[model samples]
Target: MEAWIRLSIFVAVLALMLVWEAKRPKRSGRVNRWHRWRSHLGLIVTSSVLMRLVVPLGLTGIALWASEHDWGAFNQFELPLWLAVMVSMIALDLVLYWQHRLFHRVPWLWRLHRVHHADPDFDVTTGVRFHPIEMILSLAIKAATILILGVPATAVLIFEIILNACSLFNHGNVQLPTKLEAGVRKVLITQELHRIHHSSVKRETNSNYGFSVVWWDWLFGSYTDQSRAGSDNVDIGLREFREEQRNTPFWTLLLLPFKDK
Candidate 1:
């Protein structure tokens, strides 16, 4: 059921991307690098499948291993199902908010995270362009969260769905009316807010790091409410990475954190 939902969302996002690209004005005079776009699309599809399989498997394996050792901590938690789901989602988002901020603040982690930032274009595909290594690290974080917080698997599933859905929505190219965007931005992260994070300016790129809720950015003082340069006027890609490295294959992207770029 989860897999089907994911697939449906992916297809819808791809269709949206096509429309966005088609409607985008050519006045900026920047040529649409079709080959690079295709490569990025391929990476998104591949990484989505890999992450969907690996993350759940990794979590389940850890759960089974802990069960064998009589570490029944997750089962021991007696919270009501609804409370468990709500608390787990909130707790996970809090952790993710800080973790994402850390990736920008800490240079070492930024090396790994820069792969996602190196895209010269920002669209729906950009949301899923994370390195596989980063996904593995995220899974480790999830395992730790489950062990420490005793989060139910069902809550984890719900959070995953919410996270994925919001990611696609924010990275998407859909435009919203100014008043509507302002209202939504108060509670949720919107495309306008997230697009600023992809701006060429380091200051803008560092703000609005929340994956779903906008509250974290507000609470942490990372919130930037201003609109960015129009998508065409905005520059993407990291200053530290070479242009050639931006198109590196999956294996190279996986090993980028260790390599001296």
Candidate 2:
């Protein structure tokens, strides 16, 4: 039931992004949407299957186990359920912020993380393009966080769903009015902010690492206001993935993390 609800939101957000991008693209003709979507969608499907099979006991189950065993911080405390839920969600986001940073800074992990930055374009589909290994490792880390923090299953589900929805929104090519974007980004990561993370320039690539909440980047001094290159001129994707055909097929994306740059 939880999986179904998340899946439903994912599909709805994807559909909305596809239509919105068609009407107001951030960059003109940067993406071969047909080819890229196939590969990105393939990555999503592959990662989802691998995670379901390998990590059958997801965060909610972990949360339940931890609660029943009284095995975590919140379980040990006498806080209100609402307070527990809110604190857990905020703390989880902080953990994810550092997790994303470590993936970028660490060599072995960067090899997998780069598969995501290796795309030639940014869009809603690009949001779901992660290597199976990265996804599994992320799942493990999240499970550990849930256990340590005693995050409720409902809060975990809410975080997961919001992460999915926000990633799609921030990765989409849909352009928002400048004023509107400025306001929205104050609370959530807007597409403009996320696009900087996908820039070909190494400096821009390392900045704005936040996924859902932009506050982490702002507080960590990694907040980048714009692409070093102008929005229209910003080159998307990693510098090494210059070959246009690298992202066209599903198999290529699967093997990408192992390929030499």
Candidate 3:
């Protein structure tokens, strides 16, 4: 059921991206690089498979291992079902907020994260452009959180759905009406909010690290509004690694962090 929902959402998002790309004004000097499209497709398909299938299988093993262990911490806290789920979501966001910040602030960690930033264009596909190593590390953190918090699998599933949906929504190049954007920003992170985070400027990229909720950034003092012109004017991608890397295959991208540039 969840798999169908994810696939439907992915298709909807891809359709929206195609429409937006078609409507967007063409730049005279900037030629469309059609070859990169294959790499982008490869990235999205690979990540979708990993997140929707491979990670879940691995997580089942981790859950089984955790069940056999005497992890008293998982049972330490007791709360109402609603409260427990809420707290678990917030805790996950908090961890993600810091993890994202660290990816920008720490040079070594940035190498793994750079795969995401290396995209020449920003779109829905770019949202899933994370290195596989980074995804594994992220999964490990999530597994640890589940073990420590004893969060329900249902809560994890709900949160994952919301996270993926919002990620695709925000990463797509859809321009919202001012009134709509204002309303959405009050509750969810909109594309305007996330685009600033993808700015070429390190400082901008370091802010707005929250995935689903905007409040994490607000609470952590990393939130930045894109109302200002300069906030959205910056370029994207790392200056040092700006050369096109579309030639790099899936295996190479998987092993990127370990390889010398």
Candidate 4:
């Protein structure tokens, strides 16, 4: 049932984002969407298979188990259910912000993390383009956090849905009204801010690490108002992988971390 709910929301939001990007793209490209989707979907499938084989129940299962065993921080409280859910969502996001920062700062980790940044374009599919190892590590980290925080299982479901949806939405190529982008970004991460993170420029790539929300970047001083080259002109993808084929092959991404540039 939980899996169904997550899957439903994931599909719904993905469809919505895809449609919005098609209708109101920030940048029109001649790139083949089907080809990019094939590669991106392949990567996602690999990671999903890995999770099913190893951690069949996923993070939500871990949260449920932890709750039953009375594990984590919020378990000690008899607070109202609504308060617990809201507080846990914020706390989890805070940890995720720092986790994202670690992925950039740690050299070995960046090797896996760069698979995401290597994408030559910024689009909705780019949102799901993570290396399998990164996804595995993320699962482990999230499980540990859930157990430690003793977050309610319901909150876990809500957070996962929101995180998934926001990732797709932010990574999308959809254009937004200038004033709305300004206001929405003060709370949620806007696509404009996310494209800057995908910039080929080293400094910009290191900034705007938050995929779920923008507050962490603003609070941590990693927030850059606009790309130095301007959003429209900024180059995307890693400088080292100038050859577009480097990012297209599933085998290349699978072995990217171990390969010599």
RMSD, every candidate, angstroms:
3.7, 1.3, 3.7, 1.4
TM-score of each: 0.80, 0.96, 0.80, 0.96
Q: Between candidates 2 and 3, name the one with more favorable TM-score.
A: 2
Tell me the tens digit of each residue's lDDT in model 3 across 5-122: 6568767866776577557612111214454456666766776567656566444345445445634244455557688667777777788778888887787888888888766556
Global lDDT of each candidate: 0.71, 0.86, 0.68, 0.86
Off by over 4 Å in 2: 244-247
Question: Candidate 3: lDDT of 129?
Answer: 78
Residues 3-118 of candidate 2: C-alpha lDDT, one tens digit per residue: 88889998998899899988877776555678888878888888898888986777788898899999889999898988998999999899999999999999999999988898
Q: What lDDT does candidate 2 reach at residue 258?
A: 80
- Let me know the TM-score candidate 3 reaches against the reference structure: 0.80
- Of 1 and 2, which scores higher on lDDT? 2
Rank candidates by lDDT, best first.
Answer: 2, 4, 1, 3
Number of clashing residue pairs in every model? 0, 0, 1, 1
lDDT of 4 by residue, 1-261 (tens): 888898899999999988988888888653567777888889988998998787888778988898898898788888788998999899889988888889999999999989888888789989899999999998888888899889888899999999999999999988689888989989888888888988988899889988777889988999988999997887888879767544377787788787676
- What lDDT is obtained when candidate 2 is compared to the true structure? 0.86
Position 95, candidate 4: lDDT: 84
